[model samples]
Target: MSKLEILALSGSHRHGSFNTALLDNAKRLAPKGVEIKIYEGLDKLPFYSEELDGDSIHPEAKRLREAIASADGILLAVPEYNFSMTALLKNALDWSSRPAGRHVFVGKPTAIIGASSSILGSIRAQLHTREVLHALQADVVSRPEVLVTQAATKFEDGALKDETARLFLVQVLDNLVAKINTSELIKTASQEKAS
Candidate 1:
Protein backbone atom coordinates (compact mmCIF):
# COMPACT_ATOMS: atom_id res chain seq x y z
CA MET A 1 0.00 0.00 0.00
CA SER A 2 2.94 2.32 0.52
CA LYS A 3 4.74 3.90 -2.40
CA LEU A 4 7.23 1.69 -4.24
CA GLU A 5 10.79 2.82 -4.81
CA ILE A 6 12.30 1.27 -7.92
CA LEU A 7 15.95 1.81 -8.72
CA ALA A 8 17.02 1.75 -12.37
CA LEU A 9 20.51 0.99 -13.60
CA SER A 10 21.64 1.85 -17.11
CA GLY A 11 24.60 -0.05 -18.51
CA SER A 12 25.92 2.75 -20.70
CA HIS A 13 27.74 5.90 -19.60
CA ARG A 14 28.06 7.50 -23.03
CA HIS A 15 27.02 11.12 -23.44
CA GLY A 16 24.01 10.16 -25.49
CA SER A 17 23.54 6.61 -24.32
CA PHE A 18 20.35 5.02 -25.61
CA ASN A 19 20.11 2.95 -22.46
CA THR A 20 20.15 6.12 -20.37
CA ALA A 21 17.47 7.64 -22.54
CA LEU A 22 15.41 4.52 -22.18
CA LEU A 23 15.66 4.79 -18.41
CA ASP A 24 14.62 8.42 -18.55
CA ASN A 25 11.51 7.48 -20.44
CA ALA A 26 10.83 4.71 -17.98
CA LYS A 27 10.98 7.23 -15.15
CA ARG A 28 8.45 9.38 -16.92
CA LEU A 29 6.10 6.50 -17.69
CA ALA A 30 6.24 4.83 -14.31
CA PRO A 31 2.81 4.33 -12.78
CA LYS A 32 1.53 6.66 -10.10
CA GLY A 33 2.53 5.74 -6.52
CA VAL A 34 5.78 4.30 -7.85
CA GLU A 35 9.05 6.19 -8.02
CA ILE A 36 11.74 5.06 -10.46
CA LYS A 37 15.18 6.52 -9.78
CA ILE A 38 18.28 6.02 -11.92
CA TYR A 39 21.54 4.94 -10.30
CA GLU A 40 24.34 7.11 -11.69
CA GLY A 41 27.51 5.85 -10.01
CA LEU A 42 28.34 2.77 -12.08
CA ASP A 43 31.10 4.54 -13.96
CA LYS A 44 32.64 5.61 -10.68
CA LEU A 45 32.84 2.06 -9.34
CA PRO A 46 36.22 0.40 -9.48
CA PHE A 47 36.46 -3.18 -10.66
CA TYR A 48 35.36 -5.59 -7.96
CA SER A 49 38.13 -6.79 -5.64
CA GLU A 50 37.85 -8.95 -2.59
CA GLU A 51 40.66 -7.10 -0.88
CA LEU A 52 38.79 -3.79 -1.06
CA ASP A 53 35.38 -5.37 -0.51
CA GLY A 54 35.89 -5.74 3.21
CA ASP A 55 34.88 -3.14 5.79
CA SER A 56 36.84 -0.62 3.73
CA ILE A 57 34.72 -0.86 0.58
CA HIS A 58 34.63 2.16 -1.68
CA PRO A 59 32.01 4.80 -0.82
CA GLU A 60 30.38 4.44 -4.20
CA ALA A 61 30.07 0.69 -3.78
CA LYS A 62 28.51 1.22 -0.38
CA ARG A 63 26.08 3.69 -1.88
CA LEU A 64 25.15 1.22 -4.62
CA ARG A 65 24.57 -1.54 -2.11
CA GLU A 66 22.39 0.65 0.09
CA ALA A 67 20.28 1.77 -2.84
CA ILE A 68 19.65 -1.80 -3.99
CA ALA A 69 18.89 -2.94 -0.48
CA SER A 70 16.29 -0.25 0.12
CA ALA A 71 14.50 -0.31 -3.20
CA ASP A 72 11.30 -2.29 -3.59
CA GLY A 73 12.41 -3.51 -7.00
CA ILE A 74 15.07 -2.94 -9.66
CA LEU A 75 14.90 -1.95 -13.33
CA LEU A 76 17.85 -2.46 -15.65
CA ALA A 77 18.44 -0.77 -18.98
CA VAL A 78 21.07 -3.14 -20.27
CA PRO A 79 23.45 -2.35 -23.12
CA GLU A 80 25.35 -4.89 -25.12
CA TYR A 81 29.04 -4.75 -25.95
CA ASN A 82 31.00 -7.62 -27.51
CA PHE A 83 27.78 -9.67 -27.40
CA SER A 84 27.57 -9.33 -23.61
CA MET A 85 26.69 -6.86 -20.86
CA THR A 86 28.88 -3.81 -20.48
CA ALA A 87 31.65 -3.94 -17.91
CA LEU A 88 30.01 -1.09 -16.03
CA LEU A 89 26.88 -3.12 -15.46
CA LYS A 90 28.70 -6.34 -14.68
CA ASN A 91 30.95 -4.49 -12.31
CA ALA A 92 28.03 -2.94 -10.52
CA LEU A 93 26.49 -6.37 -10.14
CA ASP A 94 29.72 -7.76 -8.83
CA TRP A 95 30.10 -4.99 -6.34
CA SER A 96 26.56 -5.38 -5.09
CA SER A 97 26.76 -9.16 -4.77
CA ARG A 98 29.41 -9.26 -2.08
CA PRO A 99 30.15 -10.43 1.53
CA ALA A 100 28.41 -13.72 0.74
CA GLY A 101 25.53 -13.75 3.23
CA ARG A 102 24.36 -10.12 3.07
CA HIS A 103 23.93 -9.44 -0.64
CA VAL A 104 21.04 -7.05 -1.29
CA PHE A 105 19.91 -8.59 -4.58
CA VAL A 106 18.69 -11.84 -3.11
CA GLY A 107 14.92 -12.15 -3.70
CA LYS A 108 14.71 -8.58 -5.03
CA PRO A 109 12.16 -8.06 -7.78
CA THR A 110 13.94 -7.12 -11.02
CA ALA A 111 12.90 -6.26 -14.56
CA ILE A 112 15.04 -5.81 -17.67
CA ILE A 113 14.66 -3.51 -20.67
CA GLY A 114 17.15 -2.41 -23.28
CA ALA A 115 17.79 -0.33 -26.38
CA SER A 116 20.45 -0.65 -29.04
CA SER A 117 21.31 0.19 -32.65
CA SER A 118 21.66 -3.51 -33.37
CA ILE A 119 18.65 -5.45 -34.55
CA LEU A 120 18.79 -7.77 -31.54
CA GLY A 121 18.50 -4.74 -29.25
CA SER A 122 20.85 -5.78 -26.48
CA ILE A 123 19.24 -9.20 -26.22
CA ARG A 124 22.53 -10.89 -25.43
CA ALA A 125 23.26 -8.37 -22.70
CA GLN A 126 19.86 -8.81 -21.12
CA LEU A 127 20.16 -12.57 -21.27
CA HIS A 128 23.55 -12.44 -19.68
CA THR A 129 22.28 -10.06 -17.02
CA ARG A 130 19.43 -12.40 -16.23
CA GLU A 131 21.91 -15.20 -15.70
CA VAL A 132 23.90 -13.09 -13.28
CA LEU A 133 20.78 -12.02 -11.41
CA HIS A 134 19.77 -15.65 -11.13
CA ALA A 135 23.08 -16.48 -9.54
CA LEU A 136 22.46 -13.75 -6.96
CA GLN A 137 18.99 -15.20 -6.22
CA ALA A 138 17.10 -12.14 -7.46
CA ASP A 139 13.50 -12.58 -8.53
CA VAL A 140 13.06 -11.39 -12.13
CA VAL A 141 10.00 -10.38 -14.09
CA SER A 142 9.90 -12.62 -17.15
CA ARG A 143 7.07 -11.34 -19.29
CA PRO A 144 6.60 -8.72 -22.06
CA GLU A 145 10.27 -8.10 -22.68
CA VAL A 146 11.13 -4.58 -23.89
CA LEU A 147 13.84 -4.67 -26.52
CA VAL A 148 13.98 -1.44 -28.53
CA THR A 149 15.81 -2.53 -31.63
CA GLN A 150 17.25 0.08 -34.00
CA ALA A 151 16.90 2.52 -31.16
CA ALA A 152 17.89 5.59 -33.13
CA THR A 153 14.62 5.39 -35.00
CA LYS A 154 12.52 4.88 -31.90
CA PHE A 155 13.31 7.95 -29.84
CA GLU A 156 13.24 11.70 -30.27
CA ASP A 157 15.45 14.00 -28.17
CA GLY A 158 16.12 11.29 -25.55
CA ALA A 159 12.50 10.32 -25.05
CA LEU A 160 10.98 7.04 -26.15
CA LYS A 161 8.74 7.94 -29.10
CA ASP A 162 7.68 4.55 -30.33
CA GLU A 163 4.20 3.70 -29.10
CA THR A 164 4.81 -0.04 -29.09
CA ALA A 165 8.00 0.27 -27.10
CA ARG A 166 6.32 2.61 -24.67
CA LEU A 167 3.57 0.08 -24.13
CA PHE A 168 6.00 -2.67 -23.44
CA LEU A 169 8.01 -0.55 -21.03
CA VAL A 170 4.89 0.33 -19.08
CA GLN A 171 3.96 -3.31 -18.91
CA VAL A 172 7.37 -4.17 -17.58
CA LEU A 173 7.06 -1.59 -14.81
CA ASP A 174 3.61 -2.83 -13.90
CA ASN A 175 4.83 -6.38 -13.75
CA LEU A 176 7.70 -5.36 -11.52
CA VAL A 177 5.29 -3.71 -9.11
CA ALA A 178 3.10 -6.81 -9.21
CA LYS A 179 6.06 -8.97 -8.36
CA ILE A 180 6.94 -6.75 -5.42
CA ASN A 181 3.40 -6.87 -4.16
CA THR A 182 3.27 -10.63 -4.46
CA SER A 183 6.49 -10.97 -2.54
CA GLU A 184 5.14 -8.78 0.26
CA LEU A 185 1.97 -10.85 0.40
CA ILE A 186 3.89 -14.09 0.70
CA LYS A 187 6.15 -12.67 3.36
CA THR A 188 3.17 -11.47 5.38
CA ALA A 189 1.48 -14.87 5.06
CA SER A 190 4.59 -16.65 6.23
CA GLN A 191 4.96 -14.36 9.20
CA GLU A 192 1.33 -14.88 10.14
CA LYS A 193 1.70 -18.63 9.92
CA ALA A 194 4.80 -18.54 12.07
CA SER A 195 3.02 -16.40 14.66
Candidate 2:
Protein backbone atom coordinates (compact mmCIF):
# COMPACT_ATOMS: atom_id res chain seq x y z
CA MET A 1 0.00 0.00 0.00
CA SER A 2 1.12 3.51 -0.70
CA LYS A 3 1.97 5.86 2.14
CA LEU A 4 -0.80 8.08 3.42
CA GLU A 5 -0.31 11.79 2.80
CA ILE A 6 -1.20 13.85 5.88
CA LEU A 7 -1.08 17.62 5.82
CA ALA A 8 -0.48 19.26 9.18
CA LEU A 9 -1.70 22.80 9.82
CA SER A 10 -0.94 25.06 12.75
CA GLY A 11 -3.47 27.82 13.33
CA SER A 12 -1.30 29.86 15.63
CA HIS A 13 0.82 32.67 14.22
CA ARG A 14 2.84 33.43 17.36
CA HIS A 15 6.57 32.96 16.89
CA GLY A 16 6.72 30.65 19.88
CA SER A 17 3.26 29.16 19.68
CA PHE A 18 2.95 26.04 21.77
CA ASN A 19 0.26 24.81 19.40
CA THR A 20 2.70 24.82 16.50
CA ALA A 21 5.21 23.04 18.67
CA LEU A 22 2.59 20.38 19.36
CA LEU A 23 2.27 19.80 15.63
CA ASP A 24 6.03 19.48 15.34
CA ASN A 25 5.95 16.84 18.01
CA ALA A 26 3.21 15.05 16.16
CA LYS A 27 5.47 14.80 13.11
CA ARG A 28 8.14 13.19 15.26
CA LEU A 29 5.70 10.58 16.57
CA ALA A 30 4.01 9.70 13.29
CA PRO A 31 4.15 5.98 12.43
CA LYS A 32 5.98 4.51 9.46
CA GLY A 33 4.42 4.84 6.01
CA VAL A 34 2.58 8.00 7.08
CA GLU A 35 3.95 11.03 5.29
CA ILE A 36 3.37 14.33 7.08
CA LYS A 37 3.91 17.89 5.83
CA ILE A 38 3.16 21.08 7.75
CA TYR A 39 1.27 23.97 6.13
CA GLU A 40 3.09 27.10 7.30
CA GLY A 41 1.51 30.02 5.45
CA LEU A 42 -1.79 30.64 7.12
CA ASP A 43 -0.72 34.13 8.04
CA LYS A 44 -0.42 35.05 4.39
CA LEU A 45 -4.03 34.29 3.43
CA PRO A 46 -6.48 37.13 3.15
CA PHE A 47 -9.97 37.03 4.53
CA TYR A 48 -12.36 35.14 2.25
CA SER A 49 -14.39 37.21 -0.20
CA GLU A 50 -16.18 35.95 -3.31
CA GLU A 51 -15.51 39.17 -5.22
CA LEU A 52 -11.74 38.78 -4.80
CA ASP A 53 -11.85 35.08 -5.76
CA GLY A 54 -12.12 35.70 -9.47
CA ASP A 55 -9.65 34.49 -12.08
CA SER A 56 -6.86 35.98 -10.04
CA ILE A 57 -6.94 34.48 -6.58
CA HIS A 58 -4.03 35.09 -4.25
CA PRO A 59 -1.06 32.78 -4.84
CA GLU A 60 -1.02 31.81 -1.18
CA ALA A 61 -4.67 30.82 -1.36
CA LYS A 62 -4.02 28.80 -4.48
CA ARG A 63 -1.13 27.03 -2.82
CA LEU A 64 -3.26 26.18 0.23
CA ARG A 65 -6.06 24.86 -1.96
CA GLU A 66 -3.68 22.68 -3.91
CA ALA A 67 -2.18 21.30 -0.72
CA ILE A 68 -5.57 20.33 0.66
CA ALA A 69 -6.69 18.90 -2.67
CA SER A 70 -3.72 16.58 -2.82
CA ALA A 71 -3.77 15.40 0.77
CA ASP A 72 -5.51 12.25 2.02
CA GLY A 73 -6.12 13.81 5.43
CA ILE A 74 -5.53 16.97 7.51
CA LEU A 75 -4.17 17.33 11.02
CA LEU A 76 -4.99 20.70 12.55
CA ALA A 77 -3.25 22.05 15.63
CA VAL A 78 -5.29 24.97 16.88
CA PRO A 79 -4.74 27.47 19.67
CA GLU A 80 -7.67 28.94 21.53
CA TYR A 81 -8.33 32.61 21.07
CA ASN A 82 -10.82 33.86 23.65
CA PHE A 83 -12.13 30.28 23.83
CA SER A 84 -12.49 29.95 20.05
CA MET A 85 -10.30 29.05 17.11
CA THR A 86 -7.88 31.74 16.05
CA ALA A 87 -9.19 34.09 13.35
CA LEU A 88 -6.25 33.14 11.16
CA LEU A 89 -7.15 29.46 11.09
CA LYS A 90 -10.82 30.12 10.53
CA ASN A 91 -9.97 32.46 7.69
CA ALA A 92 -7.78 29.85 6.06
CA LEU A 93 -10.67 27.40 6.12
CA ASP A 94 -12.96 30.02 4.67
CA TRP A 95 -10.59 30.65 1.81
CA SER A 96 -10.22 26.96 1.09
CA SER A 97 -14.01 26.50 0.92
CA ARG A 98 -14.67 29.07 -1.77
CA PRO A 99 -15.61 28.59 -5.46
CA ALA A 100 -18.35 26.42 -4.02
CA GLY A 101 -18.27 23.70 -6.64
CA ARG A 102 -14.50 23.36 -6.30
CA HIS A 103 -14.22 23.43 -2.53
CA VAL A 104 -10.95 21.85 -1.31
CA PHE A 105 -12.22 20.91 2.13
CA VAL A 106 -15.17 18.82 1.11
CA GLY A 107 -15.09 15.17 2.15
CA LYS A 108 -11.57 15.49 3.55
CA PRO A 109 -10.62 13.38 6.55
CA THR A 110 -9.52 15.60 9.47
CA ALA A 111 -8.33 15.48 13.06
CA ILE A 112 -8.09 18.43 15.50
CA ILE A 113 -5.72 18.88 18.41
CA GLY A 114 -4.72 21.89 20.45
CA ALA A 115 -2.35 23.20 23.12
CA SER A 116 -2.75 26.16 25.44
CA SER A 117 -1.23 27.67 28.51
CA SER A 118 -4.70 27.70 30.02
CA ILE A 119 -5.98 24.71 31.90
CA LEU A 120 -8.75 24.00 29.37
CA GLY A 121 -6.06 23.50 26.75
CA SER A 122 -7.98 24.87 23.80
CA ILE A 123 -10.58 22.11 24.00
CA ARG A 124 -13.36 24.49 23.13
CA ALA A 125 -11.51 25.61 20.05
CA GLN A 126 -10.96 22.04 18.95
CA LEU A 127 -14.66 21.29 19.35
CA HIS A 128 -15.55 24.34 17.33
CA THR A 129 -13.11 23.31 14.64
CA ARG A 130 -14.67 19.85 14.42
CA GLU A 131 -18.07 21.40 13.91
CA VAL A 132 -16.74 23.61 11.16
CA LEU A 133 -15.09 20.63 9.45
CA HIS A 134 -18.38 18.74 9.57
CA ALA A 135 -20.17 21.70 8.03
CA LEU A 136 -17.60 21.62 5.26
CA GLN A 137 -18.43 17.93 4.64
CA ALA A 138 -15.16 16.68 6.09
CA ASP A 139 -15.04 13.43 8.04
CA VAL A 140 -13.54 14.41 11.42
CA VAL A 141 -12.19 11.86 13.85
CA SER A 142 -14.14 11.97 17.13
CA ARG A 143 -12.01 9.88 19.40
CA PRO A 144 -8.66 10.26 21.10
CA GLU A 145 -9.17 13.96 21.37
CA VAL A 146 -5.95 15.88 22.22
CA LEU A 147 -5.86 18.99 24.38
CA VAL A 148 -2.52 19.65 26.04
CA THR A 149 -3.05 22.07 28.85
CA GLN A 150 -0.28 24.11 30.47
CA ALA A 151 1.54 23.65 27.21
CA ALA A 152 4.53 25.67 28.34
CA THR A 153 5.26 23.03 30.92
CA LYS A 154 4.38 20.07 28.74
CA PHE A 155 6.61 20.78 25.79
CA GLU A 156 10.24 21.80 25.45
CA ASP A 157 12.15 23.19 22.51
CA GLY A 158 9.27 22.45 20.09
CA ALA A 159 8.98 18.87 21.26
CA LEU A 160 6.37 17.09 23.30
CA LYS A 161 8.58 15.77 26.07
CA ASP A 162 5.71 14.56 28.22
CA GLU A 163 5.17 10.82 28.00
CA THR A 164 1.41 10.95 28.50
CA ALA A 165 0.90 13.67 25.94
CA ARG A 166 3.00 11.79 23.43
CA LEU A 167 0.95 8.64 23.92
CA PHE A 168 -2.30 10.54 23.49
CA LEU A 169 -1.05 12.16 20.32
CA VAL A 170 -0.11 8.75 18.93
CA GLN A 171 -3.64 7.49 19.53
CA VAL A 172 -5.02 10.59 17.83
CA LEU A 173 -2.85 9.92 14.80
CA ASP A 174 -3.91 6.28 14.71
CA ASN A 175 -7.56 7.31 14.70
CA LEU A 176 -6.94 9.87 11.96
CA VAL A 177 -5.09 7.32 9.78
CA ALA A 178 -7.86 4.77 10.20
CA LYS A 179 -10.50 7.29 9.20
CA ILE A 180 -8.52 8.36 6.15
CA ASN A 181 -7.98 4.79 4.97
CA THR A 182 -11.65 3.95 5.42
CA SER A 183 -12.69 7.02 3.43
CA GLU A 184 -10.30 6.11 0.64
CA LEU A 185 -11.68 2.59 0.49
CA ILE A 186 -15.20 3.91 0.29
CA LYS A 187 -14.30 6.29 -2.48
CA THR A 188 -12.63 3.52 -4.46
CA ALA A 189 -15.65 1.25 -4.11
CA SER A 190 -18.00 3.98 -5.22
CA GLN A 191 -15.86 4.62 -8.26
CA GLU A 192 -15.84 0.92 -9.05
CA LYS A 193 -19.60 0.80 -8.78
CA ALA A 194 -19.91 3.71 -11.18
CA SER A 195 -17.67 1.89 -13.60
Which number leads on TM-score?
1
Over 3-80, each residue of candidate 1 has an lDDT whose tens digit, in order, gives: 899999999999999999999999999999999999887999889899878889899999999999999999999998
lDDT score of residue 152 within candidate 2: 88
Backbone clash total, candidate 1: 0
lDDT tens per residue, model 2, 26-48: 88889888988988889988888
Clashes of each: 0, 0
* Candidate 2 error regions (>4 Å): none
Instruction: Please estimate how well model 1 matches the true structure, expressed as its whole-model Cα lDDT.
Output: 0.93
Model 2, global lDDT: 0.89
lDDT of 2 at 34: 95
